[model samples]
Target chain A: QQPVQSPQAVILREGEDAVINCSSSKALYSVHWYRQKHGEAPVFLMILLKGGEQKGHEKISASFNEKKQQSSLYLTASQLSYSGTYFCGTEGRGGADGLTFGKGTHLIIQP
Target chain B: NAGVTQTPKFRILKIGQSMTLQCTQDMNHNYMYWYRQDPGMGLKLIYYSVGAGITDKGEVPNGYNVSRSTTEDFPLRLELAAPSQTSVYFCASSGGLAGRNEQYFGPGTRLTVT
Candidate 1:
């Protein structure tokens, strides 16, 4: 099943901070975060594995709570370049068939 | 390395028409996936392949088909196109480690069915 994302949209000023959350009903083995600019392909942001292993996108950070089957992306001191749609894809413990992505959270940053 | 590439960046199809969206990856990844994103919506998986000659359906697989004849190519086929099938399609590839590897995505193909 597809994961659920909170705060469908958010607007922030430069230097502001924002948090996007993703949760799943089933146990998740890993969570992947991606950012997509308008009319562009989705770019990999980070991946948080079940045992707290995280990788990719040094500028962006995220946390995964294995017990809760949830993950959160943190954007601190947001930059104008951060404006885009964010998606979180989840892999269930059953297997890594493919990621089930969330509807997406739109983040807009103004100068 | 031209991580992932897609052909026919934009296309328009008439109802009941057929077309194929081509996807290729130079990364030589073992896993490839196809996803469709409707306007103002997130991506829905259409099909995926673990390797050459292996494929499977995903969340929204109707009206679509796929083939993975080689490790580098995976193409999505739309048969009897309908208006509802119009969407931006993306092809992604990941390394051998399923959940541990980050997926690289292609630029995407925009299709409109009239």
Candidate 2:
């Protein structure tokens, strides 16, 4: 099943902080975060494996809670360049080689 | 490396027509995938290949077919174009190794069927 992302959309000011959460009903083997700008392909951010520690990219980091089957992307000191749609993808035992992604969280960082 | 590249960045097909979406990666990755994204919707996998000779269906594999005869190429074939097939198609590749599942995506192919 596809994961669910909270706060379908969010607006943030430069230097602000924002959190995008993704939750799944099934147990997760791994969680991946990606960012997509308008008309562009999604770019990989980080991947958190089950029982793995948190991973970060620049000012953005992510956490995976195995017990809750959830993951959250943290964008700190958000920059205007961060304006884009962020997606969280999940893969579990039954998913095999495919990844099911959440609808996505639209983040707008305005000047 | 070119990462991943897809041919025919845009196409419009008439109902019942057939076409192929070509995808190629220069990174020599072991895993390749095809995904379609409707407007404002998350991507849904169409098909994937774990290696040159292995292919598998994904969530939305209907109305589509794929072949992976070589490591550098994975092409998606649309047998009979339908309106429902209109969407942006993306091709991605990954190393499929430990801590290397991060997929590198192509720009994407936008297809419209009417």
Candidate 3:
């Protein structure tokens, strides 16, 4: 099943912070985060495995809570380049080769 | 290395027509996947392949088919095209390992069905 994302859209100014959350009903083995600019392919941001792990990429980071089957992406001191749609893909314990993705969270940053 | 590449960057198909979207990867990854993204929506998996000659259906697989004859190629086929099938198609490849499953995506094929 596809995961659910919170705050369908958000707007922030430069130097602001934002959080996007993703939750799945099934037990997940790993969570992957991606960012897509307008008219471009989605770019991998980071992946958080089970065991309540957290991963970071520059000013962006994410946390996965296996117990709750939830993951959150954090963008600190947002930059104009951070403006894009963010998606979280989850791999369940069911041994599926593909990850189920959330609808996506649109983040817009202004100068 | 051209991590992932897709052919036919843009196409327009008539109803009931058929077309194939080609995808290739130079990463030698064992896992490849096809996904469709509607405007303003997230990626939806259509099909996936574990390796050569191994394939499986994913969410929203109807109206589409796929083949993985070689480790480097996975092509998606759309038979009897419908307007609903018009979307941006993306091909991705992954290492297929526990912690190394980060997918590398192709530019994408934009298709429109009339």
Q: Choose the strongest candidate by lDDT.
A: 1
What fraction of the true interface does each of the listed models get right, in terms of native contacts kept?
0.61, 0.48, 0.49
| Model 1 spans > 4 angstroms off | A92-94
Docking class of 2: medium
TM per model? 0.97, 0.96, 0.95
Better of 1 and 3 by TM-score: 1
Question: Candidate 2: deviation at residue B44, Å?
Answer: 0.4
lDDT of 3 by residue, B67-94 (tens): 9999999999999999999899999998
**Candidate closer to the true structure by DockQ (higher is better), 1 or 3:** 1
DockQ of each: 0.69, 0.56, 0.58
lDDT of 1 by residue, B1-114 (tens): 889999999999999999999999998899999999998888888888889999998889999999999999999999999999989999999885547788889999999999
The Cα error of candidate 1 at residue A7, in Å, is 1.0
Candidate 2, B8-79: lDDT as tens digits: 999999999999999999998988999999988899989988899999888899999999999999999999
Winner of 1 and 3 under lDDT: 1
